[model samples]
Target: MAQVASLFTLFTHHAKTFRDLVYSLRNSLLKTGVFTNEKVAEQQVVSVINFDIHLRRDADGHRYIERITECVPVEQEAGYPETFRHKTTTEEKMTAFMETMLEYFRRSTDRPLYVARNVIEYRDGSYVAVHPLSERSRKEIAACLAGPDQAAFEAFLAVHWGDSDEN
Candidate 1:
């Protein structure tokens, strides 16, 4: 049960980090006009992904492949009217948006919360659907961010979830 709790906690941390990363990217684009002003203010940027993990051994021992994906709308049309200033602006904006998002996603990889979900499970129907993060969990995670005690935090989660399981 403790093991399960630790896994759950670690997964929760990563989930939040990923969520924040998307928000950061979205804000960057919105502030710079990559997305329409109204769309950026009124519409939320939604993210969904199917992730997997595996255990294998090689000359360098085991490794992990983690992928984080976000869904954003784009125009697929190729050619446009030569005199269409709006279309030209849109295309340039799209290029800038993609570049910004890619850079943000890359930086997310260095975050411990994102990189340390090695023990998590992302299978369908495996979620418990609780609030994204509890107050205590959020506080602990923030502290970890400041000083980096991820392993200790993982252990704390193990105890927390273990108690819940026994009940």
Candidate 2:
């Protein structure tokens, strides 16, 4: 079947943020038998998703975008730190392992699949940037563009990310 297309997909949902939206999506898909395994379904959602934007309204019914959040995948780049690998003593290894666990616990959320960061936020009657896009997302977005737009968006990303390598 043929269907109309847009530059990006859109869905009107009651999710308050990226985290909420992902959790809701997983639950809905599982409950309806769209997917059976919780872990697999969550990974599917997070792996394909990039950002979620929330909108807000005032008493007068004027609507504005509240925030734009990116769904950050679990970063495994930490790998094996030299210091951690060099720990030869049992006590040292125990402490290192404990520290790693502590760090994980600190960032753990109710839905620990992804960490949502607000890349853009509305504040004081204006929209402002809060965080920059991850390099992976930047590259993915760039790959979807062409011609002048590709060049222009790349420039914006270079400046926004504050790193030429990111674009």
Instruction: Using lDDT, give the best candidate's number.
Output: 2
Q: The CA-based lDDT of model 2 is what?
A: 0.74
Model 1 per-residue lDDT tens digits across residues 32-140:
7767653333233331211223322346764433332222222223343233333358777677667666656654444221211222433342422221233344454
The lDDT per prediction is 0.39, 0.74
Candidate 2 residue-wise lDDT, 1-167, digit = tens:
01135445667789876767888887977998979998667877786567787889989999999998888887534543335556999899888877876666655433366778888899998878677887778777878988788899878865765564321
Identify the runs in model 2 with alpha carbons over 4 angstroms from their true place: 1-8, 76-111, 158-161, 164-167
Off by over 4 Å in 1: 1-16, 34-44, 47-62, 65-167
Please report the candidate that would top TM-score against the real structure: 2
Which ten contiguous residues of candidate 1 have the minimum total lDDT? 110-119
RMSD in Å for all candidates = 17.9, 4.9
Screening candidate 1 with a backbone cut-off below 3 angstroms (N, C-alpha, C), the clashing residue pairs are none
